[model samples]
Target: MRILFRLVAAVATVLVGQTAVAEPLTLIIARAVAVPDSVSGQAMLSLKLTPDSGKAFARFTGANVGNIVDLSINGAVVTSPRIAEPIRGGEIMVSGTFKPGEVERIAERISAGDAKVEVDVKSE
Candidate 1:
């Protein structure tokens, strides 16, 4: 019975490995800013984009105005919302259902300048 179980597990692992893997989520961010919430005065983190990336995002949004874009962190999809308009200025406000530690982790990465978004001041 032990040998049979091992054989089954091996076959299952092989099959799983043969299956296709989904592409990881990618984000275009220039920097992240931590600020206070307006209502509750809690801490809030905002994602910003660099100038070049902002131009690219504007083009993409223009092309896919009605399409949904996935907002992710660490390859996990946090929200998939439809694009309402062209995203100019390259700033994204993250507000939604976020696990307590999840936002903290994101903030830590952003503060460390290790997140996918480039850390830079927006050129006005």
Candidate 2:
């Protein structure tokens, strides 16, 4: 599918310690699919970023190596994974605690181009 992913709102500010603090950086996704895990044979979400988005993600991950990022679909939080290292290849795999058939439905929604995939970077 030809998906156009971009960052709608790059950053939002919140009141913290009587000062404006930026947290929870949001990134829209381009392409996604539901697949089986190679080792465990469980359902997982595979996300592929566009070239531009790949660069952006690389920069984001590179800067925030030890931070946690939340993956969500249609405002529902899916998984919050710690950034171990910079993901320069643009491929992100999300394996969460999914109920039976949940991953399939999510994949269908994403394939139909109706679901909104988001990544929220949390500040420490």
Candidate 3:
């Protein structure tokens, strides 16, 4: 099963002074892995996007600095992180209070493309 992810680019419009009519961009995940945190030794989920999605993400973040980007999974909002700067890299690390086993399971599911992920950039 392939997970479909949508990135709403509302902040892009605000940055460029354009109308908020841009369609959401779809981002594809290349892979996900559970790795141990270097400092805390806790499990962490790492997500790598496909090349095209990475470029799209970089552009979106570059245009939306200081904006909040909401991340959703399975139609439920999970995290809303502020874009401090452009993320040119294709990798993202998700760290939380998840147990080791839980993180592993989540990583496996994501890597197998069994979850739907969405990112929404809202204008402040």
lDDT by residue (tens digit), candidate 1, 6-84: 9999999998876232233244666676666798655566877777767766666665566666665655555566768
TM-score of each: 0.60, 0.71, 0.73
lDDT tens per residue, model 2, 24-65: 444445777889998999999887777777777788777667
Off by over 4 Å in 1: 1-28, 39-44, 117-124
- What TM-score would you give candidate 2 relative to the actual structure? 0.71
Relative to the unseen true structure, what is the C-alpha lDDT of residue 38 in candidate 1, on a scale of 0 to 100? 95
- Candidate order, lDDT descending: 3, 2, 1
So what's the TM-score on candidate 1? Answer: 0.60
Candidate 1 — which pairs collide?
30-49, 30-118
State which candidate has the highest lDDT: 3
**In model 3, what is the error at residue 106, expressed in angstroms?**
1.7
lDDT of all predictions, in order shown?
0.63, 0.73, 0.73
User: What's the CA error at residue 108 for candidate 2, in Å?
Assistant: 1.8
Return whichever of 2 and 3 wins on TM-score. 3
Error of 3 at 99 (Å): 3.8
Cα-based RMSD of the predictions, in order?
A: 13.1, 12.5, 11.5
